[model samples]
Target: MRLFIQLLGRFGVRLDGEEVPSIAWKRDRAAALIKLLAVSPQHRIHREQIMEAFWPDQDVELAGANLRKAIHFARRAMGTQDLITVTREIVAFADEVQLETDMERFEAAATQALRSGDPAECEAAADLYGGILLPDDRFLEWLDAPRERLQQLYAAVLRKGRLWRRLIALDPTDEEAQRALMQAALDAGNRGEAIRQFDQLRERLHAELGVGPSKASIELYERALALSGAEPASPAERIRASLAWALVHLQSGEFDKAAELARETRAQALGGGLAREVGEAGAVLGLTAHMQGRWPELFRSEFTEWVRSRDEFVPSVFDGHLCLAEFCLCDAKGHAAIARSAQELMCVAEDADSVAGRALAGLILGEIARCAGDLEEAETHLNEAERLHAGANALSGRVLVLERLAEIALARGQKWQASRLVQRALGDATQSWLSNHLLLRLQALAVRAATTPEKVEEAILTGDRLLTPGACQPCSMGLRIASAVALTQAGEMEQVDRRLNEAERIAGMWQGGPWAAALWEARGIQRQAQSNKVRALAAFAEAAARYEDLGRPLDQSRCLERMAAVMPAAGA
Candidate 1:
């Protein structure tokens, strides 16, 4: 049977242009299910996947039953059972049913337009755009990637020269068009026109974005200046160039180079009274030092102090990262301050509608709450963070939140839940960046240690893989502390001592900073396991002092409790 599906403007199913009545659909879920099937790449979906996506909170049998009922409703809506194909393992549109959607036509038009390189073709493609795949169903997660892909394709076609001119006419802040025009002008030996284009772009960005030109735009302008044999760049331009390099270094994990460049940029920004630049630079510096495991005191005493000293967060966009990094400097002693700071970041993120900011804030708040023994609050915060990240489709943030939640689960003696969470996290962590993935693997290893004794040896091998030569020092030390704890649990006294010593040596390279205390604490656990009460007492005492000095009362209290448990009954 011939079918025309209108998925662009408003969703509809029509048999040869005659619309299917809305009353035919028994429930909204039926209509939604039809739409889901229509948008699927192959017009087929796994039965289990549909159940999980649509009826996630239901049990397996209930969800499967719901799927069958939804499929029936969909068939009823279309007035033909033959229009849908069903099986025990899969659900799909009928292979024999001749069905066409506006989306397929739109995609075809877009591809043709890009291939033809004709402005008329681009315009035709743009005419097919109806804002979204399903405007009324914006809350649907499955539509997000498809909608975004279409939108990106739409924007990309506009990059054609003639189409670009039209784009600029529609929106002067179309930087892609501006860049293309500038480059085209340069190629045509119209250097003056290129410079003029850059000037217009700078002005438009300033007027609209409430910020300076991006590094790319600035570099373009500088290149034009150099081509014209003009005077050298201003000091500000040089600093911006350096800052751009610093960002590249940071992404590439060259912390030493990044830190050096960031420090220079920060100094320059401070002298120029560029508050936003200063904050960005400091954030980079803090991140660089964190990654390098160097100058830990400076992270707190210098960078963190400066950020707080400001009346308000200068570069509000950087507030989330800076605030979260500041959260790191707060040890157990600073619970109130940590909570207050996280709340501030969370509020800032909420105000900005920044998903990353909200995710980071929620993760930190949840961890702090967990340490403070507020399991309910911890779960709420962590789940919020997980939801936020999942909505944004950000893998790293979700993985981090999952790790925190798993830790909380372990703390509450929910080992089964923790094990499941860790398994999921490990999959994503292995796919993430190197440092994060390594640290995450260590966390997962710790979770592994909880369920069985033999897994401790597995944890040791995992640690070895992570700490093999040329490891990132700070991250390695963090993993070492964790691995030491695992060894202590396994009663591997000698291995624990060696690992603890390596942790100390590495921490010393970073000036025996705040994280060093954890090494000593792990050492105490090892001593206790070895039945060396006197040495264990000393190690615990030192760790407690270290935590107190670092303004972390929670860690201090933890050490004190361990000490209390190991102490003798003096009155006896």
Candidate 2:
């Protein structure tokens, strides 16, 4: 009977026609032993050598017994008693055992195919080659060199086959068995498969490897789809198509239209009752609302509803947690509520191994600390967030963390460090409009540290850019107040009053928050600089009142100190 050994795909072994799935084979020890024999030009291995190769650590007696057991299993699996003829002295394949391994067939076929110039032959060689031999079984040191050589040969054969397929497919007379073979070649990576087949392959590949198809394969398949005039019906395509329309509206700053399309996609996902899809769509909608400054609509209701509906919605938790963090920081009544929400989010993130979740949790902790006037603790948490963001390749997360760090640095009088961090934050915040406000505020602080008049003017210009009509309210207020401060320093009294009035009006609309307190304090400082003692005192008192109302006791005390500096000691 004919006997053979071959590698299945890359990591499996087959003896004759039977497969040996387990590494601990009772048969000829699969290719590992055969490989030892094949490499020994003498076509025979001394019993001691075979024992030493496989069971180097075992005693001679036990090793010999294991080798004999392997030989017995191999012979039985091969169905040929004479396949591996072994004596008491040595082991070798019988003369009747004609080895027909795929590697040998593939190499021989590849040489002939290259000489014949036949596309079909080239494709046949490629089909036989499959992938590298025993790629994942690296514990076998003897297989590595030969495996690498076979891999190179296989890659060459595949390249030749790919070229032949394209050439033959372009020529009608040449496209016979060549076309079918070429299709199979392209189908190795499932590149030329129909959309349904491709999707199936994608799902299978992801299940097996924990990754999607290579980018090259996906691009090639997309081109093939265009050639065949068949639209891909994959879920990725559906998601991308809807996302593209939503982004188009988003880019045009049409929040309503963006929100509508995003909502429709989210509803569709929810209707399908797929938790992952619902979470993905809900995240997109929540992000859209954040950019549109419609936080209440997205977080308080829409996001909460989505979170309550989905059982395994991870992204929804992140979105809801972030929204609550922002709400707590912006709303005096929401601090404890936000902290509770953040704790819940951290639990979910730790459970899911989510890097983004951990980073956001750190940021939330920092916000809580900052709100409590624990600047040192706030900086520590923000630093932790930055470190996590850096390790996880989360650019936007890093940007937010850096922005918070800059704010703390400025508060601590580390102006130079704050300036550098603010610049980095601005560059990273390019994708998020909400961050632009922060960028503007940082630029103003940097300018305050600059000794040159040019720097002050540049800061004023930055403030003007941030004060555009559609700017986010908090960001615009920050810029307006900063502009007032910059104008006062430039000795432009008229422009300072104009900017201060605008800032006060914007603050009135903004009610109480960290931003409102800052603006009021900025106006008071400008009045003090202008020698308007009464106005300065009144402005400082108003700022102190606003800070006290926002639960910022430290800021309230600082405002009172500034007021005392400007006013006389009445009772004393």
Candidate 3:
């Protein structure tokens, strides 16, 4: 008899590829008994040992009776009593009966792969794992140790060079995978790529966990530096670390902390005569300002300082133009400048063979395409950006790309696709070790807006969780508006005013780039909810104007359509 068993993800048994029904195992321990026997090294167990393992609480007589029932069920489930022999106090699988199992196959494949030193075999092992062993039975005391042992072995196989990428894809925050990637780059004699890898790891660590890399990771990085013939971290290195951390704050959406750190780093770098560091710090500040929608603040931004002293910074055109790109991308009215600056960065990135620079440049172009409602172009640029990010194993860039793709899918009216993408982004964020409050809150707005009516309440609750202070004000405005829309739909009219009040207050008080346009749209939603046709039309019109001023044709088109909806239909 060819008996096959599956013990990963869930446990099941098959005979010649035919499934065994639950009726055979039914609410009982038959399947578990069969699984225990199948994976045992001996494929035979003492009857008393089995009873003690499964029913330590029962008296010996009762335990013996239960064991008898278990044996009967196992035989029926397997469709062959000849395979199991219970003689006196001993029970064992027949020596002649051959058993096949995914677990043993997975382990055997992994062992063979290791013995042969083959990447393909390692990948096959990874595929065989599917998930941790017997995930449904993970909580059982007997299963925990074995499951962990197998999981560790599976992870080890996946950590082999090139295969580390698969390990990271499985768990973005996996320190072992992160360390291996950096080591791989250094071993390849690509100092720059190695440094980029460290930067990526640090950013992900700080953003996701509100902490820095572990001591072991720092040690690994020091090794990379030594291998690349770089001197111990100089003053320039200090400034680089500072700027890198600032970016962690920025990309994770902690606008205030990021801005503060960037400003300090820029000043420190300038004082120390580290022009490269100064430019890096300035660029970090610019991206921060861009995300916060503080347009006037952006113009008076550190990029201006970098621009003025561009001559002092060697080959300043690339850094200078990149800084310019960051500034232009921050401003709602600087759409033309975003294009001009992004193009400049793209040229520099390509000329220099800088993966990060290329990814960022492509991201800028993708965002611009999104603003234009050219989903096709946006997809093209974003895909290119993702490729660059993947090549470097840059987790932060990849997550941002995924979120942008989700937004594009939302714009295309593919709700299911959009939701899945957003969920994927959220999943990546979690696994990336990100202190993800802001990203989660910001994404909650998109999810809230796109969710089904049945799920509206859950999304609103998610929005309410963001009511605490210190959220990125610009993004917060959108979250507030989305919550209000959900509340209005659910007929929670009293809470709508509070939500709208907060959104309107942010729009009036903060210079949050296109967040202001979003606020206008939210006002229209609020007025419509109040059943005030005239006011809603006016609000939509105002929103349309703001979007037009912001150079966002897509948003402008959406606002204009809303205005049209309320106008002719309701006493135009």
Query: lDDT of each prediction vs. the true structure?
Result: 0.67, 0.60, 0.67
Model 2: per-residue Cα lDDT at residue 442: 56
Which scores greater on TM-score, model 1 or model 3?
3
lDDT of 2 at 339: 67
Identify the runs in model 2 with alpha carbons over 4 angstroms from their true place: 1-263, 267-331, 431-438, 448-452, 569-572
RMSD of 1: 17.1
Report how far residue 479 has shifted in candidate 2, in Å. 1.9
User: What does candidate 3's lDDT look like per residue over 1-572, in tens digits?
Assistant: 67777887777878877898867776346777786787666677888888877776568999899888898878877778887888767787776766888888888888887777788878877788867676544324556567877877787788752587777665556777788878787778876676777777765553444245666666676666566365566666566566656665776778899879977987777678875566556556656665665533454333233333432432221342242332245445666676777787677666666666677678878988888778899899999998877675545456667777877776777778867766666654555432244365435535454666657766665555544344545445556776676666665454566567777786786553676667668778877876788888888888888888877788899988988788776874
Q: Superposing all C-alpha atoms, what RMSD in Å does each candidate have to the true structure? A: 17.1, 26.1, 16.0
Sort the predicted structures by TM-score, highest score first. Answer: 2, 3, 1
Off by over 4 Å in 1: 1-333, 434-448, 511-514, 547-558, 569-572
Error of 2 at 454 (Å): 3.6
* Per-candidate TM-score against the hidden true structure: 0.45, 0.48, 0.47
lDDT minimum window of 10 residues, candidate 1: 311-320
**lDDT (tens digit, per residue) of candidate 1 on 94-204:** 778887888888889989999988988888887786655775554356786887787677776677525777666545677778888888987887766777786676545
